[model samples]
Target: MPEYLVAIRSGRFDLAALKNLNTQRKDQISPLISVRGTSLQDFDNFVDDWGDRLFYLDISRQPKDLKEPRQQPDKPQKINILLERDLNNPKNAYENKRSFYSEQLEKNKNIVPVVSWRANDPIRDIARCAILLNKGGEQAIGVRIPIGKNGEPSNHSKEALSTILNSLPTPEKCVLIFDYQHISSFPSTDEDSWIFKTLSLAQNDYNIERAFLLSTSFPKERPDNGSSMITACLDWEWQATLRNSFEILGYGDYATSDPDGEMDFIPGMPTIPYAGYFSDSHLIWWTKKEGKDKEFSKYIGIAKEIVRLDYFHDDDFCWATIKYEEIASLGGGDKSGYGNNGVWLGFRINQHVAAMLNLANVNDSQIDEEIDLF
Candidate 1:
């Protein structure tokens, strides 16, 4: 007698239901995250100073799901996890989806620990539409801070998350995109030295599929919370490649489901406040994969190793191409008061054209139709 559902996602990527499903798709190379304002003419017009690179990103865009009219589910919004199935078959569909996520973490004591779809993909959706937010506005108070069960930090959600990141509003204008040879293990700066020549590391692996990331805010000037990237507090391997691919969007705080506060992200052992914390500019959807999708090149190599990076990637976004979940029951979540790196953005290809398309036979990376992607 198993049958339960209340999934209100749209956590990200729904460009008006993929432009009312037309097809012939292309243009997915948006990786950003800067946290504060960067001067020097915002670094040579980073991607023509973003927005309407033709109209695809629509200036500071974010705030969709506002196109009402009805019936727009052209299929693609799935999530199935049965890591070895059977929870005593009473029609056990992964024990009624883990008892409806343990009754929404026992009726939400302020929700946070959600990600159980243990890989081996069993079907994750999102195509002509479904994912709705990303960089969208209004979502702070640390996302809904409450998390306890040992992942501590509920001093009344740390005094209402320090009064909502100290009366917020001052953390926008982000645009980061890396891959200079698989992040050449970040760490080498000469005082942000013009991002070491406009954002360093590029022995020419096609320079991470270039699109835009100009500097002035990162170390080169340091102001937006003085971040220079490479987090996990400094280099806990960049906090397991950004808290394991963070995706529980809108940005941060929801500690417990296993919180282990003060930093215990654990996928590869993260324990924080090392030497990083910054956010804003979160929009990952950059495809190039032709190397026959070796499972999205092992899920962005488990997203630069941020201890299994969660908040969203662990929810396994673009799940083989799309279908992300746990967006806080869909009211949208994770962008909690920005900081903790919400763990940087994603997808920035060109590791030498993905290792020469896995050894020769290349020719896949195109789509510069004067730029215009959403």
Candidate 2:
């Protein structure tokens, strides 16, 4: 099992970040990648780039218009993929969906089916999937259960989970995930208590091999502050608190992007130039409104400000930091242009993953040094 889990949409920026991660960092993290409304060609491109790396592939949010790939590629090597889909799509017939899973399993020897227990989906349907996947020749499967809005499992979640688990042969082989979609604030004491209780039940009843608590607090829009803003890394703080209390649970978040998804960029719109830096516990942002400076110049200014911050790491820290320093050093006359929004996002996410990996492995004595390393 990976030490950290990151939930990200399967966009160009997100995929670029994952592709650029050093081999060491890649081994330590598993990305729950959501492929929503992506074309078949794009999906093939992702697989070709990723090669055989182990990652969770979620098509739960995929629309009906985007069809799954029918022609299987030549079997040079088995890909390590965890295939997942939600039963909430009323348009797709259950039998047809199951056939898709069967086809996927037949093509990729190492692919594991993930059974997601959504609150709105019927318990019987979830169980049927679990049973089918277990008998489909895979050694183990994944079970993802969503935490309710009240910051705890829904009242019937445990019972629903039990039904699904009973359908499988070995609970010990199951990978469990408790997903808390969008977090508005830090976890309260009561919320912590309930999470701990649910985790305990999962461990005691199933003796599962791995479990992760996933959520994100990244805002959908930048705050209306004047030139800059700072947001606490509440998701990290909450995960750290839980790890301190319970050592068994692993960590997961939506990377640096908002849980609702990335903001759409409008063409021909004069957007404010901004740069985001991820510190140990906060995301510091600097922005420049439209003014005398050109848009690219504004970005250069923002980059300069980011690199000068006290928490800023040197160029060797990661690819993003290197880019920050490079942008800061460019002369006004130089035509070397600052990258667009997707490019900047890729930089931020690359740095975020590296920083999260460092934090996850650091001890209490190393905390101070880790913060300074950011």
Specify the highest-TM-score model's number.
2
- Alpha carbon lDDT of residue 202, candidate 1? 21
Judged by lDDT, which candidate is best? 2
Off by over 4 Å in 1: 1-32, 35-44, 47-49, 53-374
Which residue runs does candidate 2 get wrong by more than 4 Å?
Answer: 62-112, 117-119, 155-159, 188-192, 262-271, 281-297, 334-336, 365-374
Candidate 1 per-residue lDDT, tens place, 1-374, comes to 00100111111111222222112121222222110111213222332332332111111111121121122268544221111222212232234433533443343332222212211212121100001111232210111222233322334434433333233342121112211111213334343432233223321221321212111111211222212232111222232233233221111111100011111122444322212112111211222111121122222322323222222233332221121222122222333312221121111111111111221122223311232223
TM-score of each: 0.17, 0.79
CA displacement after TM-score superposition, residue 317 of candidate 2 (Å): 2.1
What is the Å distance of residue 195 in model 1 from its true position?
Answer: 35
Backbone clashes, candidate 2:
0
> Residue 162 error for model 1, in Å?
11
Tens digits of per-residue lDDT, candidate 2, 29-113, equal 8877655532344555655666556666554532331333233469443221212343344223244455655665554544455
lDDT of candidate model 1 versus the reference: 0.22
TM-score of 1: 0.17
